[model samples]
Target: MGNENSLREQKILSYTGFAAKANKIVYGKRGLRNYIRSFQRKKVILIPKDTGSRVKLDVIKHCQIFDVPYIELNYTKSDLAKTLGKQNISVVGITDENIIEGILKTIQ
Candidate 1:
């Protein structure tokens, strides 16, 4: 069971990396908010478990307004930063439907 959980986490990280490479992901609070407001594409927002309450609340509010789906991942900010090759990435928004689907599957 532990191995299965680790494999699932790896798969989620892999999808995050692929999305970053494909330029289908937006990081940071402002960037994600802008992407949500400006982009009409289907998106899913990933909020790390360790995100601050204010930022997480704001993100959830924006997502609600935009009717975008969001999920809280078991990973932390550092985990996401490492996976996406970015620094201090607390919020990640994925704009690609296929990649969103892949991530959703892994998380579920």
Candidate 2:
């Protein structure tokens, strides 16, 4: 069970990496909010487990208001940052439908 969970996490990280490479990833709450407001594309948001309650609630609220689907990942902000080759990020928004589907599927 532990191995399965780890594998799933790796797959999610892999998809996130692809999203970053394709420039479809938006980092941080501000960036994610901007992306949600500006784009018409189908999007998904990933909030790390370790995110602060205030930030997490704010992000989730924005997502709900905008009708964007969000997932709270088991991984931490640092885990996602490492995958994306970025500094620590509280939230990540993916605007590409294919990548979003891939991540959602993996999580499910």
Candidate 3:
């Protein structure tokens, strides 16, 4: 069971990396908010576990306003940053519907 969970986590991270490589994701708090405001194509917002309450609340509010789904990842900010091949990324907005579905399924 532990191995299965680990594999599932790896798959989620893999998809996140793919989304970044495909340019279907937006990173950073400001960038995510801006993407949510301007892009109707946003499918899901990924918030890492280490995100601050203030930023998380703001991101949740935006998700509510835009009718976009969001998931709080089990990973930390550094884990997410490493997966996305970036740095200090707390919030990520996924614009591709297919990738969103894949991630949602994996996490669920």
Please, what is the TM-score per model? 0.82, 0.86, 0.81
Give the per-residue lDDT digits (tens) of candidate 3, residues 1-108.
877777777787788899999988887767787788875663778888899999999999998998888878778989989988888888888877888889779867
The RMSD of every model to the true structure, in order and in angstroms, is 2.2, 1.8, 2.3
| Candidate 1 lDDT tens digits, 22-107 | 98888776788887786666778888899999999999999899888887777899999988888988998887789988877876
Model 1 local distance difference test score: 0.85
Range of the 10 consecutive residues with the lowest summed lDDT in candidate 2: 35-44
Error of 1 at 25 (Å): 1.5
Q: What is the Å distance of residue 40 in model 3 from its true position?
A: 3.4
True-vs-predicted CA distance for residue 55, candidate 2, Å: 0.7
Q: List the candidate 1 regions with Cα displacement exceeding 4 Å.
A: 1-8
- Which residue pairs collide, candidate 2? none
Better of 1 and 2 by TM-score: 2
lDDT of 3: 0.83
Residue 28 lDDT in candidate 2 = 64
